[model samples]
Target: MTQQPEKEAIITVENLEYAYCDFKAVDGIGLTVKKGEVFSFLGPNGAGKSTVINALITLLSLQKGKATVAGYDVSRDPQKVRESIGIVFQEITLDRDMTVWEILEFHGKLYSMPRNERRIRIEELLDLVQLRNKRDIRTKYLSGGMKRRLEIARGLMTRLKVLFLDEPTIGLDPQTRMRMWDYIRKVNKEGTTIFLTTHYMDEADMLSDQISIIDNGRIIITGTNWQLKNTLGQDIIYLETSDNIAAIQLLRTLPSVKDATKKFRGILVSVHKDGTKVLPKIIERLRENGISIDTVNLKKPSMDDVFVYYTGKEIRDDPPGKNGTLTHRPGGS
Candidate 1:
């Protein structure tokens, strides 16, 4: 049997740090993104996700540590790094007056792509994004989802190795967000390595090949979806009992119970052993103690659970405009 070759790292960082005067936006952190993989920086707002991306894309100058993108050092070869990657900002950046085709065409031109090549690429991208019919319509007339698709199309105008998407599906409806996710999957399937940052739990859960959870300017954890969840325990059991306080205290004494936390109506238990076996023991113990079980649920750990377990708080999705830095243009302008 032949051994498979190891995947190459397309992006690499070492002790990377960035600051805004006195405030450190990104602490001494390090990460690696492999070729043809959808790597995500998952974090809440103000976690320095955008700052790391900005530096990689050459939008912000690196102050400390070493980093490389597409085989070029970001500090020494910033332009090469920019040329090797495409960017889709968190906010919509289309010119209200420009047509879909015009938006893509302008991008290709701005990068000095040949006239014939630019036209051909525009046609291909329009078809790829499923916007052929809306090619000539002004962007102001397009819906939110349509505008997002257009931005993605513009990002792919050049033959690039990586695409940086900073919260690509932020303000869309649930249906549109799912649809956009499909488009992103298609892009990855076609062999473009993706590096995206997002606050949405489901977005990271569904889209990432590998996820790095960042908070307070530091990376708390990094792993595949299942790998991260597995850290919590074998299974999770949510129990609501008549005497919640008494129940949680009793739950902690069980050998199978790894840990327990008091919830509003009940207590959530993380067990090291199979929940089916551990569950019966829980019910029997509670019944023996005269505590009545109101509700019981058993499931595997989810990304939400993993996040809360590490961060010690629930992740909240910030509303679009509350962050103030919500609106951003491509090229870090």
Candidate 2:
């Protein structure tokens, strides 16, 4: 019988650590991303998401540990690692004066692509990103979403094995963000592994095959969305009642309910079984106890809930520094 070969990791980090002056930005972080998987580093502004990404992509020097990208050691073979990966930064980097075509053409040229092959790849990428119609238009004239799409296309010019996107859809409108996700999915389907960082819970839940939640420069948890949500072990049923205190006490007695508590303006009940099935019973029980419900909602455990459960705070509450600037370790450090 022939034995199957073990799959190799496309990206790997072990005991990685980095600091800014006396302040550590990343602490003993370690992870592995398999080939062709969408691996998300989910965190808020200064949680060292970018620092980890930078170190892996050779933007920052490894301070205390080992990391490899596309079979090349990040510290020893920075150029080889860079050649195997592409990056789309959080901030826009396009030249306003250049047309979308010009920008992509310049990138291909920098990689020393053959003119004919470069032209073919440029057209292919433009179509992939749905920017073929805007190819000749100046980048500055394009909408924020369009510019983002163009950046993604440019990032693909090198035939990268891994693509690093730092908050790819951060500032786009919801509809635009969704459209961008579609494009990203298309790219992923064609076999480039995606490594992204974002604070948006829904985005991470929707896009990632695997997720690692980082907080205060440390990884709090790592799992698939479903696995992480399952860790909560109960479904949440929230309802506003005429007598929230009474409802909470009544819910605690139900066989299906594991716990009950007052949250915000409602009573939050944790049920051992499916919340949807148990919801009607909960309503009926409340009515039997003479507690009138004003509004009721049942929510499956979401990535947002998982983040809060682990970090003890919402991701949005991670504020910037005193001057409203993000405090990140210098990339070269």
Candidate 3:
């Protein structure tokens, strides 16, 4: 009957806010990331994800509230916070002319890593990323996946308590993204806390120890993937009927039906009881009301469903000035 102790927080934010001129990008938001976990920030583009990250990593000055990373205050000890984290940007940032080994080696030097230490870390990372054989190849010659691996490797050149991965696999193919996930898992197992922002729902579902979904400069929900999905109900039934609006309204009248939301082409119903039991009732009720059912799909809730249920829309590409990017230096200055 004993409660478990809370894990130590490696990153903490309290009523954090940031704005671009008069436009507020990050509203008063607060959350904590425990040590040694892959914590994902899931949001549509321009959802203030980039702004919050930029603040936590000390790229943007804190305009209000507080944030601490690796035990250093982002506002007061920005340099210390920077030194404790490594960043992999959404865009590929390697100098095409530089060799793989040189990219990592130069990053180590930038952080003032000692000569022997830099060499040792370089070898260790190249091996870790499976780029040992291509160590001497110029980055431009590498495939997209290879370039991503190199970027991850470069980020780890210095010893870090946390790694900030911004859209880490944005442009990679599915198979390569899976491979990158493996590398990321290995890194997390090795004890570095991973703070991830990603566009892929499957990516967040598969890799996150915890997830926070942000929208319009605010966090909509924060929980494990299962926790978030469970909020919708035991099962979800997607229905496309002759009268979608009336179908959703009648669905809400069922005692077993938890809630229903209208989708573009259908309505999604969440059931408190077994969907099989609820499904029959749903069809009969609609029939009584003269609503013809064209389609009915039953399944467990997914991350996509959870996102839509809460945000009322699908994730979209960020528009300019909503979540703008800056060229990231591998290790913070």
In order, the Cα lDDT scores of the candidates are 0.84, 0.82, 0.86
Better of 1 and 2 by lDDT: 1
What stretches of model 1 exceed 4 Å from their correct place?
Answer: 127-130, 173-179, 315-333
Which of 1 and 3 is ahead in lDDT?
Answer: 3
- Identify the candidate with maximal lDDT: 3
Better of 1 and 2 by TM-score: 1
lDDT of 3 by residue, 275-320 (tens): 8888998999999999999998999999988877776657543432
TM-score of each: 0.87, 0.80, 0.89
Q: List the residue pairs that clash in candidate 1.
A: none
TM-score of 3: 0.89
Over 123-206, each residue of candidate 2 has an lDDT whose tens digit, in order, gives: 988987788999999998998767877876787776679999887776666776787788678778899999988777899999
Q: Which stretches of candidate 3 lie over 4 Å from their true place?
A: 1-3, 114-117, 124-134, 141-143, 316-333
Candidate 2, superposed: residue stretches over 4 Å from native: 1-6, 173-176, 241-264, 267-270, 276-294, 315-333
